[model samples]
Target: MDTTMITIVERLAWTSVQTALLVGLVWAVCRLVPSLGAATRCRLWWLVSLQAVAGLFWAQPLQLAVLPAPALAADTFIAGTDVAYAHAPALPTAQVVSAIHTVSSAAIGAAPWWALVLAALWISGVLAMAWRTAAEWRRTRALLAAAQPCADQTLVEALNLAAEAHGLRRAPRLWMSAQIDAPQVVGPLRPVLLLPAGARALQGDALDLALTHELQHLQRHDLQWGLLPAVAQHLFFFHPLLCLAVREYAQAREEAVDAAVVEGRSERRQDYGRLLLQLGVMPRPHLGVASAAPSTASLKRRLLSLQQRHACPKAVAVALTVAVLAIGVLPMRLVAAPPPPAPPAAPAAPRAPVPPAPPSAPAAPPALAVPPATDLPAAPPAPAAPAAPAKVQEKTTSTTTIMRSSDDDSLSMITHGELDLGKRPDRAYVLLDGNASYAHGAMDDVKQARRDLGADSQAFWFRQGTERYVVRDRTLLLQMQEAYADAARIGTEQAKLGRQQGELGRRTGEQARAVAMVAREEALRAVRHSTDINRDAAAEAARASLEASRAAKDARGNAELATLAQRQASLGAEQAALGQRQSQAHARAAREAEKIMAQALQDGRAQRL
Candidate 1:
């Protein structure tokens, strides 16, 4: 494997482990603090940002491992070392910090162009919402002008009085509607109190009650404040909790509005609840420009406040402040800590100075010395007692092969041998002294390769480490297959004949004679027939068994043939590789031999030229 490829694999492994750990840690923390509020949740989401930074760091080494263009490499080096590091000569602490900030900001802030496009779409949506709100506000004001004025003198008198009391230049547009039972704040710019025609004759306390609810909405500026939830929804659209938080925020605002309404008013509990129920029945409108009747819970909260009739604003404020402070402070204490001090550096080892060797000593020899060509020694003779080659040794060997008949009538060759996948010392690899080569493949490939060699081979079914190895003796395989086929045929034929004789004896009712004479004769004939079948089977199985045996024998040979063919087709590649290695070796040898030659080759080469 190439060094770069190995390095990349290591880096990826390192990153994967780190990423898994980081994710698990963040997930655990999130689960632990499940009840944390929206603001803290927003801060906690910074874990995702932290994870992104970790991913960048993890991928950095992988990026460096890949082949890079010269220009890109130059640019990266200059940017990373000169700009990001910014310590080409001697950088100040602030300069280093600034450089780091610049790089980080550049990376994190680098949004795709499509992000800008999406942002434009978001802005467009906001503008559209604002326009719609404005249009609805204008339409509501215009629609109020078309409503009939209330005939009841008391409601008209209360509306005029409340509008003046709230410092309105224009009179509150008095409208009566059978559709809406309770009074509602119906417009944004000039809010109107819509009263039911049946309730038009309401006086003093009832009229005051209706006007107060509408006035509360106007004073709170609920329409503008309601836009906060809309904005929150737009930005945190991906967060479900944030969306829920927006709803809660709106509820809180509405509750606050209701609290303000009944703060001074007294003896209006049943009346307020009735007003809430009245408008609650009316269908809610789509526009945000109007404030509809409060929800049932909000109405209940309102009713509770009205019925309690207590002056407990200070207590509520104190309680809310304590809750908010506790929410904000606790998580900070848990998650934040000061940076630890740097550890002291270890002591460096001392180096000893050595004096030069005495001048009287002969000069040390060169690291590698190559003898001159003319002074080369003669080749040594071969060993006097040489062992025969592996091929010859195997030629005198005893061999056995076994063959058996399958249910499908196909022949099966069986050869027993040990498997070795480099896990065992004794049987590490099959001997392939001639016409063979060997190479390792993956586990699945090894198994398939072994199975392809035929079911009879024991080596094919065995495993060593994660690979399967085929150990084969071709001669032994062929002979044993022939023997087994004959034996199997004899056994099968005898079993069939014996069964038939037993059946005949059972039918004839002459159990003794049928089982003895006829059955014995049938058994003898079966034996002979078995022998004949065995003989024929052995002959028939020989060719196929030999072929299977040869496949095992030729596995290594076939691999070598493929490798050799591949090498032959790439002659230039081999030549180039060989020449490059040889040239380096030859150069070192020539330099060493130069001193011994003593200008002999220089003059000899000049004379030849």
Candidate 2:
């Protein structure tokens, strides 16, 4: 029945309520928003993509808002000093508090309108950029130039005729960029097959076969099929596996094309294998706008397919048709969907007076803080109170009064007490409600002892199999209280150390400032000496001119000038003293600051308990 435990339960209840509401709202949006019949109808693929992206962004803010407040409250509760009832309430407070918390959670989830707007904007911007990128690739078709002949012009012509026979539209647009390294296709709507300038001139059947394979990519619009996953990969850059899937998609498209080209042709397995090996000599770019070189894994699969020589296309088509139909309709005919799995049962709440056991209960731990009653010497005799006048008033307060038990005839005692209200014999610390809300380690110890001495003690002990169970039950509560007391002591020491360290810091700072001021004054005096030296040089020059003009200067006047120069020499000594004082003061300040820092560290260690 600790306050921290109560707070934790209350908080968890609120969290569950909020999570349920948010999940329900997301489910509702997925179901209801789809039926709106809006005029701006995007593709089903587009909308599905939008929802999936939006779900990640939308859920992020709700998670941010819900998680922090509850987490902070729970942390505070765990660190608080209060230890008391975790019961329903005396009369109504618990229910009211629970209701308020539930309502507050719902209100917070609904109230963060600005956050929701930001999330929506984020999703919109991402989708918009995706659309723009796709449009940019679409624009590349306009960049196409006139086709040039391959080195084997006759073979190129023959390939063009074969392309026409295969029902391919427009000859593949030939590009000759110095940057291109291998064959590729660029546009989705108006597609092009780009053979590197190097590959286009290569002689032989391998070159012919590679060009034919790339042309097949243009004929079937493989780029269009790849666009969604490409955009998905772009948007979900964080998901490495998704990008891998997109790469696999590109490979699959190429292999599918290869399968089509060799379907019924009278060619040996070595023919295609040679073609794959020749094409893989160069690395391809993953421009996303084009299917460049097929990946190595794709090349391997194509070679293996040639080696295996699967049944021809006509036979494969009939088999695929049967398989697809069976998968599509077989489940509905064979079995109805099983009923939804039952929801998991909620955990039972920790009850009043019957606190939860600690996460890992100690193996046969001793009772906590039930100091042996005999530890104290005999109690002092109670002084007799003089009767007061009727008008004299007194304040009622609770106190524990222990007395020797007359019935026990032993050295046993009982703590029985009541609040000394003017005209009532109301028992102290017991409420009118059935709940026993006042709990403390010392109080629990007394209660356990009293129960062990009572008439029902025998049966209770028989049922639980030990008199020690009563002590064990109350031990957890005692352990918690002792822990709280220790924490309070540590906090007190830390607070005291903090105050002392602050005072020390302030004093050291003042001393440091005084030292800095002295240093500044000494620097100013040093500057004055340089100025005096300059003035003396001018004086000596003036004296030489006066002596030359008079030619009758006396020895008395010269001696007086010498005495004045001696006075200036003494001033220089005073300047040296000032410098020495500044240095000493700075050193003293630094030593004091270091001493204070060490003291602060020691105090901090002590305060940590």
Candidate 3:
């Protein structure tokens, strides 16, 4: 397998193991401390999840220190030298003696096929989980859009009262939708309480009970808690234990929130429980929304928990929180020490000295009489060569001994030197004294030991004008020291870089949160502005409708008045015609009477005639 793949696999394996251990540990603690509140237990689970994430990025090398061998002589010395060595012993490996050598060799390479397959599998799982979560979230958002504000004034008042009773500064916006079957709370910043259309039929107290439960969810930030586990699950979808832990965490959160909602109103526990049961009969909403009512199984558990009169103690919760934090932080503390330096290689064996050749007949005595007469003061007879410095003869003796200890066998070399000053007292010195040990089982016998020691086994001395001095060689020791110093410097630099990275990460997180807060505020402002615009538009439409109704009524009244006037004119005309006719008839009747009277008169005249 290639190094990169191997390294990745190693890291993944370690991370998985650490995650499993942390989850198991937290789970055990929760089980043992049943009195710990659900909120606290849920937080513990969060800690475990975070610890698993941290383990993925944590890297530390395990190192072993190379210890110096004990000294057999008072001082240390090099072989065949009179100088005493003052420094401590060093590793005898040549490879590690170089200051530039790394503590560990490269062990990772190109990834193997199996590793690639595993990585692909993990990625696929994560993507699948993420896709599922996104789909659910989208569905939930669509459901939210279909919801409308509750129009019932009594229900609105009850919601406000419930919010006040729950000590919430701002009550979540209440919306009712026929699309949903259960009550749920959505949104983190501008929380919305969604209810089914059936909620309109609930009596005031029962409705309040439902509102209070959802409001408690908002007040306690249960949605946010639920999201943390969801994220963990998305990342570790393949890990069944993680999924289980998330499930348990969700249940605990619900139970905790339930307790909080019914804390003071102990007498109404039954009512709240009944409400939950009633809501449970309806279809549960999408997991993306935090439902006030849970599934049937969860509802049963919650109802039973409601029957309990007492809550988890504060002290127990606090203790469990601390313990959980410690457990999460414990895995990070297992850093390894730096590795020890390798031992230096043994020195090569010394060569034997060559003997001096004969003078070869003195080169035939080249013509001595030649320039004898030059007489330029005859070069002032070469000043008698200064008397040769008195020669001091030095003698040195060395002794070797082997010591056996319970754990190892050691070889010791001791050397002593004497300086002989002609016509003066001689000086004696102790040189080259130290011991080297090999683990008892490291080698077979003394023969292997001798082979390992090689030229290092001999003690030698040097002479100058009959003066002798011995020196111990510490080249390997110096190199080991340099290597150790370099390692220390690199470690210090790494620590500084780590601190800088941590600071940068923290600052980045703070900036992101600030930006998010600003964005959230802007979005809320936009929503409020839009809502006001809609409200104003609706009011204007209603006024316009009223004005149009009044105008239509006036037009009808005008038509009625005109009809009455026309009828009066027709009656007046008819009366005038009738009067005219009666006058004509009277005239005719008078004429007739006149005619008759005239006739009668004529007749009377005729009769007179």
Candidate 4:
């Protein structure tokens, strides 16, 4: 299988095992302590679930150890031993050489079908559970929308009283709904206390008790505890222990809420017990809501605990809470298994020591004639010649045939149908191996040849048997020296080229950075310019508005002044008309008076006459 897929499968299995172990630990702790508040226990479950889920993302193993393979003793045999022993050989030289050059390949397998199936099943379960949770939440939301504010003033007062008694900063909103069976608290931040329609008719004390129970949940923030465990339970629906732990968490949470409500209020404990018993018959709260009452068994336990006033001590509760938290976090550290043990080492066999070679016989002295004894006696009589000085000579041996190449007149060893030079000459190459000694010996032989056979020598002594050949070609030595000089030149050029390339790269990078900086500066300038333009535009708009307002005020004042002037002109025209009328009336009055006076005079005159 694909190693990646196999590793994924292994990690999934390990995480599942870790989660199971953690859940069991949680379950056992909850069962043992019973005093660790539901909130604390719920938090522990959440921690373990998170740790398990987090383990999936942990790509590295907890511990990695390289278990080396055991060393095996290599089979040893002498070369050409089969010929000596008259037996078949292990392998041909060519076959062994080819085997050394061979490379190994591996086939990759496909992912197993079962792993895919398991993954698909897990995904499907999660989806199904998620859908269920969503649908229930939707139902709860619909029910919440249908609920109406409680019309009873007494219940509202009781809710406020209970909240203030519990030291709640803000009283939760209270509503009455006919859809819900039991009183449950919903919403974490702005909590809502939902009461059944039947609760409307409940006695004042029972209503107070129920309100107090649900309010205790709100005050303690138990509604927020169910969310993580619910998600964990849904995701790991396959694990029975997780399901049990979730159920236990819910029960413990309700108990904790119950204890908080009736802790100090001894007188109301009976009423609270009765309220729980009454609500216990109702359907359980929706998964999205935190009910004031749990199952019948849990209700009985709550009632008994309330009656007995059984409560966890603060110190004990704190200690257990810390311990449980440690348990939850421990799995994350210990999830990885230890690496396998290394294999034992194999013992090596002892090798046989090789025998040393025997010493060579002394060389025979050159023969001299007997007549030479008579002649030599006279020659010896001339004078015992001074003994010659000994010369140091280097010994050489050959393991293959030595051939002289006509093209280059260079000596080469013939081995296994191939000519092998003592060493391949490379430019500026220093011989650091036995080849250096061979070259030094050859140079010494050439020096001796030049000293003994004149400085214009063209060839050196060539031994035809198991002895070394001395190279004496002046052209070859000169060519070798030239090659070394060329190699040194090439090395220097390469170094110079590398330096140039590095410099060029540095310059290019600097130029790129400079261009980027310039672009940034240009962008900043554009942005500043745009900001300035916008600011000027806003300022101009404000100025125009100010000018327009001033002009409008001026226009209003001019209109008011013109209206006053027109009113004054109308008043003046009315006055002038009034004066003319008055004058006409006075003239008419005078005319009438004159006529009356004339009449009066005429009458008087006629009477007198």
Candidate 5:
């Protein structure tokens, strides 16, 4: 695994841990002050997710986020210095060279087996989600394609009023979609309120309330803020705490929106809840949209939260502040104090002072000395050699065209070209006109393909409503499928066969009933058309004839079944006789071979003699 990826995984792991701890702190605060507002909890959950991401990979450490330049140290800090040992002399050259080293990796010893497993799992999940998110986006586009601006100007006016109430800078576009069963907010930028066709029929202030609910989502920028938990959850899909945190975040977000929706119209809490139930839950884009329908996971929390007071108590606020600061922000500035200054080095002994007087001869005083390589100055480096772009985006496209020369059209050779998409991912490659390698397809054709390919991607047919941050979770779907599979698996082959047989018998009975009803109806119609006199007699005759015909057919069927059984028995007897004759032939052949061998031995003896 790459070191960068390991570092990322490490941060994600710690982030999950930190988020979990923060969640606990919030939980504790909520426990102490159960009256905490939904809005407050919503904010806290948002913070937990944000704190996780901000403190981890996306941002710099708060401790070092901003710092002034350090002043230069006054003296060389020597090692081995001693105040108690008065005889110890100081050495000036023995200064501490450096404190910081070129070691950054946090993992020690051999990388664990699990790290490798997680490394492989890391990008796989991200790609899987990317694919899923794209698919969802395509569906959302198709769903929105059918949606047009609502004709009801009344609703439009109400939407504007709701937008004003929510203090939105720009009101969302109101459109009605036949594809959706409930109202939802779509698009992060240039948001649109997509309502079901049934939403127009909402009574009294119901329309306004619903519009307010969706507008609140836009106001809080819930669609964008919601993506945080989703993204973090997507990265740490296997982290149980992260999942819990995301779930908490989602419910809190919805409840917060609900609270905002009924702020002025507090009496309509029940009406709002009724409206929620009436709208119910429907399949909607979980990747990009903030659905207005309360999901099953959070529905209870949202309904209960409606009655809770919005006013936050000061004590509870203080506790939350302390918890968030302690759990989230306090560690940002925590740095280990610089290592204790090194002791001064010991002085060398003053021994051979008198021996320095020995005479020294001046030998070959000076052979010409050459300067070492280090003495020569380095050649001046090349100036201003331009660096290639960190990434190059060059696309070669070959286009074939048909041209008219004089009078007739002629096919031209392919021409290649490139379009500059500046300052993007920098190394993007797109293979357009995939229609060549991939066959042209339509909606019906794709549907047919899906029907054919449905069994291929079956995970196991299982997973849910989700936020924009992470891809959706499929645990519940999988659980249901596994439960069904378990039940089906528990049955014996004989039992399954018997059950299928019973089902077939029931279907046959139903078919017979349908046939009888059709014949009876025909008879009644014949009677209805019969002229005055012998109508009753004719009807009776017709009924008798039908019964007799049915009895005869059943008798014929029984006779055929008996004949088939007899034929099967005769075949079985023939098989047994053939087996007996085959065994007899094998015995006769063995005896003949033994006799031939004895005669051959006798002939060999005669030849030897």
Candidate 6:
């Protein structure tokens, strides 16, 4: 996986979390709060889907430390100052150095073989889901094709009357088809009301209730607004929380509509309840559609919500709405809490003081070389000191070979074959802040951080588990100033190029359009009156009509030529506009790069970095 895919996965994970939280919170509110009416509860539950969508597109990472950080394992610590302990025993290992290098490259990308396999598996699952949904849609369309106008005039009249009562200007296209048992409204844009062919045999009021239910769906704009979640459920078919959200909202929507159907009618309430139970039990199409509420476990909740008629207190409703909105803007995350301060070391037991032994000529100080400074020229002159081995630097005590710097001939250290001490000191890089470590041999600060130093300021440390390696040499910041200069030069050139192109195109377009206009006027003159080309028609009788016919034909041809020229001018103008936008983009890129460099240098760390 690349950086793009990593970012996408992170955003998806966060959005899924947001959906779960919204569903959990809203579910609690609906169950616990009885005063809130059906309409208010529906709105609250709708936030689950809405917030999910919003978070997916715009939520930024807001990591919070909510748990304790884990402890790190102890590793071998290499001290390169002394030669006596240089021959540390190697730990048991499973792989060669070359194989470790290969693994390191994969780690650099933060991807493994399993990541690619999982991504491919998810794509296959989505494709399979899409295929199933398409099959259902095709079957529904086939039913729609076979449907026809109902022969029962009374049922048709009832559908129309129900629509009128629901305040619809025109009822949806009504049809009867034996293909479906329950009445379903399909397609938002030219919606069709699909009723069973055996509708005349059932109670007229039952069908009437179904019609009113679907009409309320229309009046509330349920089908149109629902398209997002309806498609989203299938797209993220594996996600549990999003599925629950869609189902919960559907139940609330149905109960809200049911309340509307029963409003103030004491007798119709019992009949509406029967209609709901009847529809819930009937086996219909299993297509993942948003036209109706789900069945089975959800039916009981829907019925319960229907019986409750008390409106929510205004203050409580406002407070909960505000709370939901706050969740959208205020962010949180589950992050490891900061580690506790290490306990002070245990007090050492009292010991008798021992007299210090006389140092044998004080082991001669190691011959360490000063690293090259930033101000030095690219090709610094070699030092005048003769290249000769000194007595103090010689490896007389340790049998291991001692390595000396080729350029300076000053550094003297035992070669243990653990570090890049063969050809040169291990060259590592760090950010200008001196806190974050970068890849070995990196010349710039923009590279991603490989490790964080925190307060441990050791220039080199040993990592035990894999290969024992050291990070000893710290390289200075690279020649970014020169690179930035080159970018600025290019931006300046682009600015000049853009101005020249835009001006040329603008003038050319203007001239072409003006010429086209002149040609059109000349063509009009030729048609309205005889110009020099058609002057022969003024006196002659028979040839006059023939010349007029030629004039009209020529006029049409000239008009078309003028139109072509106008189109060409328009194209020229578009080219000019594109050139200007390109120039702006180059300038913006140059400025952004400059700002980053300036920020990094603000603390003067770049000089020492």
Identify the candidate with maximal TM-score: 3
> CA lDDT of 73 in candidate 5?
34
Candidate 5's displacement at residue 311, Å, is: 3.3
lDDT by residue (4-47, candidate 5, tens digit) is 55666776675666667777887776677677776677777777
* Pairs with steric clashes in candidate 4: none
Full-model lDDT for every candidate: 0.40, 0.39, 0.50, 0.49, 0.49, 0.51
Ten-residue segment with the worst summed lDDT in candidate 6?
A: 74-83
- Model 5 TM-score, all chains together: 0.46
Prediction RMSDs, each to the true structure: 37.7, 36.1, 54.5, 50.2, 46.9, 37.1
Q: On lDDT, who's better, 2 or 5?
A: 5
Question: Could you estimate the TM-score for every candidate?
Answer: 0.34, 0.32, 0.49, 0.47, 0.46, 0.48
Positional deviation of 270 in candidate 5, in angstroms?
2.2
Residue 369 local lDDT, model 3: 34
420-458 in candidate 3: lDDT tens per residue? 212322322211212332111111222233333332542
lDDT per residue as tens, model 4, 1-609: 354555556666766777788777777876787655655665666666565656656765453233443322211221122122222212222232233323211222455677767777777898999898788779778888999998989778877887898888988888889876667777665778888896434566776667766777776666675666776677678878767767766666676677777777788777777777666554455453544455567667667666554446777767766776555544343332343443422222212312211122224436752221111001001111112223323343221112122213352211110122333212111111111111112333333333443343333222222232333344433433333332233333434443443443344344334434443443343334333322655644543453344334333322322222223333333333333333343334334333432443354421111
Better of 2 and 6 by TM-score: 6
**Which wins on lDDT, candidate 1 or candidate 2?**
1
Looking at model 6, how many pairs of residues clash? 1
Clash list (residue pairs), candidate 2: none
Clashing pairs in 6: 67-337
